[model samples]
Each structure stands twice: as C-alpha cells, then as structure tokens.
Target: MKQAKTPFQFMAASTLTRICGVQATNISELLEQLRRVSTDSVFNHTFQSLSAYHFLTEGFSNDFAQWALAACNAPQMAEQLAALDIRQYESVEDLRADLVQTLESFVAAEPQRAQQKAFEPFYFCEAVTVTVPTDWRAHNLREFCEALWHVSVHSIHYHFVSARLRGPQTNDFSAWMEHSLGLPELADRVEHIDIYTNTLERVRQLILDECIPWVES
Candidate 1:
C-alpha cells in the first residue's frame, strides 16, 4: 500500500489549484476563484494576496491554502482540515496533525511581533456579512490570522506604517499604531515601549489592547 504524503510535501500553489480543477491560468485568477468560493475579502482588503500568491507560486505550499480551496470547493472534505488545528501546538502530537510541519515553520517564522492568537479555523468568517457556515468555527483561526497578518503586516495599512519609519514595514508595527490609527492616547501610553528592550508578548498585548477596541466603533 502507498503511504500518504505529508503537508510539507505538497506541490506549489498553481499546481495545487490546477489539480483541484480550478481553470485559472495565473495566480491572480486562482486567487479570485479562491476568494469566490471562500467568500472572504480579507486578502483583497490587504493586497497581500499578491504576496501570498508569489510565495505559493514560487515554492512554498501554504497549508492554509490547501484548506481554503478545499473549504470553498468541497465543503464535505473540510472536516479533514478541521482535524488538523494549528493553534497552540506544543509537541509531537500537535505536530503529528496533517499540517503540523507547516504550522511549526509558520509560527517559528512569525515576525515575533504580536501575541498572535493561534488560529482555530482554516477559513474566513469575521468580515463576511453573509450567513455563517456551520463549519465556520472549525476554520476560524487560519482565516482570521491570515486576515490579521495582511492588515497588520502586508497591506497598505502596514505600508503607511512603514513609510513613516522610512524603512521596511516589517519593523514598525508600533509606529503606525502610534501615529496613523485612531488610538493616539493609547499610542502615547506605549510610545516609550522599546521594541528591542521589552518582551515581544508585552508589546503585542499593548498593541492588541489599544488597537482592537477601535474595530467596534
């Protein structure tokens, strides 16, 4: 009998989409289909969908992409995705999940910027006004993290933040929070929190506490 391939062994994004029967000839079209079936605007809102496209097309096979497409096209198969939660995995069993290696690499490579809430789901839900899926909770973590990363790290919101630092946007999640967004008072409270000197968890908490409240208003 043949053994199953691991998540790390998956093919590139373009190839995966084609194998899944999507007719797109390029990454952009593939993403459109992905968005259509998934019904999420987070990627479009951030414009980092292109960056993700570049990553998957080049060599990296995003585990989340596998689920995203599957959830959009074949909802029944999504239970497979649900079984492999990448939330706060701590050991071999955690890594033993289908997406274990990919999630480990992903979390390890996280900019270590924010106290990221490990994703619980593999699909999008928050920004959608449509009727929520019965399986929405299962895929919430992956989609939410993807959306948050694009907004906080890859999108024009992040770009504007980076422009103020006059450098790579990756370095200044805080600068933009202090200067551009709605939390000036909160920014003032954290203005002196040294990104280098203080713990990353602390910094992330400050940002989350100050920034997330504005989402409701």
Candidate 2:
C-alpha cells in the first residue's frame, strides 16, 4: 500500500528536490539519518550528500545556504514528523574531517561576522554539540543525543521564519513554510522567535518556566 505522506514529509521532500535535485523519498529517511549519525557527521554529510543534488537542480553559482537550511528540517518541515528510525553512516572519521574543513572555509570566507556569531549561546551550543571532538571535548552518546535534539529544535524555528517570510506561495519551496510557523498574515509579525514565536515559544516557556526552574529551585 502507498502510505499517505504528511505535510512535513511533503515539504521536506519538495525542498530537497527543489534545492538539491535528489528526491529523498520521505522525511523519515532524513530523520533516521539524524538519529543515527554523530552531530558533526550529520551536519557534514548533509552538505556533501546534497551538494550533488543542488548542482543538478540549481546551477553551481546559486547560493547553497537555503538548501542547507531546508535539509536541516527547519520549521517548514513541521508536518513531516514521523517515528524516528535508525540508520548508520559509513564513515565517522570522514564526516568529522569534512565538517572541520567546512567550518574552516566558512571562517576564512567571513572571519569577523562568523566569529561574532560563534560567540552566541545557540551557536556555541551548536558548535559544542555538533563538533565536540574537534574541540577536544568528549560527550557520551546520551549527551550527544540531547545536544542533537536541542540543535534540531533551534534550526527548525530559525529557517521556517527566515525562509517562509521571503517567498511566493506557488513555489514548491515556500508552501509549507507558512503552515509550519502558523504565522498570522502580514498584519502581526512575530517579534522574537525563541520567546514569542508560536509553538516553540510555548515549549520554551514550559521547559524554562515550569520544568527547569522548578527543578533547579
């Protein structure tokens, strides 16, 4: 039987196809990849794997940032949530090397701004969570998993708002973005994503306001 795909799945698949030219079949494959690989590996492998996809879809000169954001399963991929499945990467070592190289290039390309952004908490968390070993820091599998969870949430909210706010509804790329963010049309714009943003805001408030503070206090 051909199972019906969810909104999130469809968006992610469309985003991948539009940006990378490779049809990932479903978001489940992407999520499974997220679960099984190390953070660094996932981040790096994503670029390496999708570069070919993008080359075929959009010419080489086109910016790859949006594709990266899309592949990261940003808010635009919301409805696609499915049961997480497990898969394995062939080379952890290679993944790490590629991520480090990518970071280096990013820094060299844009040193001042990149460094400033790197100092921010969320980016710091991302660096630590994804590229821990490069920093000569070691985290157990459980810690790494927790880090991936945090990064995934942050990345989704970031891209959904940023990307969806810019494009046309008819475009395959921009369609689900609005639904994912649940934004009210142009009249009322969200001021802050982490705090006053849709479901994420409620989630953050719950975790910070009720849960963490209560536990800490």
Per-candidate Cα RMSD to the true structure, in Å, reads 20.8, 19.9
TM-score of 2: 0.20
Top model by lDDT, which number? Answer: 1
Model 1 scores worst on lDDT over the 10 consecutive residues at 7-16
> How much lDDT does each candidate structure score?
0.31, 0.28
**Candidate 2 global Cα RMSD:** 19.9
Q: What shift in Å separates residue 80 of candidate 1 from its native position after superposition?
A: 55
Judge candidate 2 at residue 144 and give its lDDT: 23
Model 2 clashing residue pairs (backbone): 8-79, 8-80, 9-80, 20-53, 20-54
Residues 95-166 of candidate 1 have per-residue lDDT tens digits of: 233333433343345424112222333332222212112221111222322333333222322222212323
